[model samples]
Target: MKHSILLVEDEQKIAEGIMDYMNGGEAEYETCFTWADDGDKALELVYENEYDLVLLDIMLPGADGFEICKAIRAKSYVPVIFLTARGREEDRLYGYDIGCDDYVVKPFSMAELSAKIMSFLRRSKGLWEKKSSIEAYDIVIYPDKLQVFVAGNEVRLAPKEYAMLKYFMEHRGMLITRDDLLVRLWGYDYEGSDRVVDNHIKKLRQALGEPGKKIKTVFAKGYRMD
Candidate 1:
């Protein structure tokens, strides 16, 4: 089956290139490329169409990426990939804050874009099919709705924190590395330090309480929730 994609970009050339690569190629998955030059139209398309993924350019004509992302998050968690100019830390953070699933700076390679698309698709599939409520001993993960409730009380978690915890729960007892977490949670263009992962883990542990120590840190490696 072809996976539908909503591509919002004002640039014609770049948009064409992406469409050709994604839809014109002979890949394992099929892609339906839908384009929008502005935010208002993008929002319309989102509500009107059933897209599995959204490739959003931050700078739009009518509506900006941030606004579009916020609107989308209000209704759906369909994976959102932000396309913007590099070196805009604030913009990238804003995208993530508004529930963006990934970020890719401008002038990026088509291969990189395709790889990121596939990665998110895989992650989304895994997340959607997850049990409605995840209970690994005392650690509970509500994968279906992107919520975490530990020990009967819902624990508010950041986007990255939720992704991290979900990954750990899905692969319990596995030794996840900083690189692994960075790539999986933040994607290829992640600029923050691995310390971010540590901080989130610390927060997760604290929220889990009681058996918070269950998330063992493997010295110089990473962490595992066992």
Candidate 2:
């Protein structure tokens, strides 16, 4: 799936380079951008649709990135990263004060920027952790950061997939029926086939890869993680 990002920068060439480099970059998950060269246009697009992430420049045409960030924070929890030439310690702190998920100074490495974007996206979707790590087999779940590791390599999963993994790990060895999953995870109001549980579980297992064998299928019933 493509990660939708909003790039709000005034410089023409820099914006183009970012869009081209990031869109063409080899990422675990692809990234696509909607470019807004000025702050007014950025806010306009922000109001138009929801984005997975926003890359904002501090100095802009209409409202500054900080103002845009404040407006964004007032309504949405989407991850915002400040992309600016300002490298002062105070500036970085203020950006953080205004709910900036990350601060990237200008003339930065595109590869490093790409990594930061992916990390934030993972954090945003991995439920942004709090608790300590939970381990089973070679799979480790860190609720503190909401990160998963398989054989010590970090793995990123969609929110639902992460939830399914956690639930399975928590209820290891128990016969969890599809209906149970539907009610507990998908909610009682979910109007869909119980097969949706299977589909999610399939994706979850695929994410786990070789370690996925830890999640056992219980013929026609649901699943067991042991």
TM per model?
A: 0.67, 0.56
Residue-level lDDT tens digits of model 2 in 39-131? 888888888887888999999999899989998887676778899999986687677656676779988998888887776676464342323
Once model 1 is optimally superposed onto the true structure by TM-score, how far is the C-alpha of residue 82 displaced, in angstroms? Answer: 0.6
Best by lDDT: 2
Q: Cα RMSDs of all predictions?
A: 6.4, 15.8
For residue 221, give model 1's deviation from the true position in Å: 10
Q: What does candidate 1's lDDT look like per residue over 35-147, in tens digits?
A: 99888899898877667889998878888888888888777767888888744656665666567767789889998889878766765655444447656666677676887
Task: Report residue 216 deviation for candidate 1 (angstroms).
Answer: 9.0
Global lDDT for candidate 2? Answer: 0.80
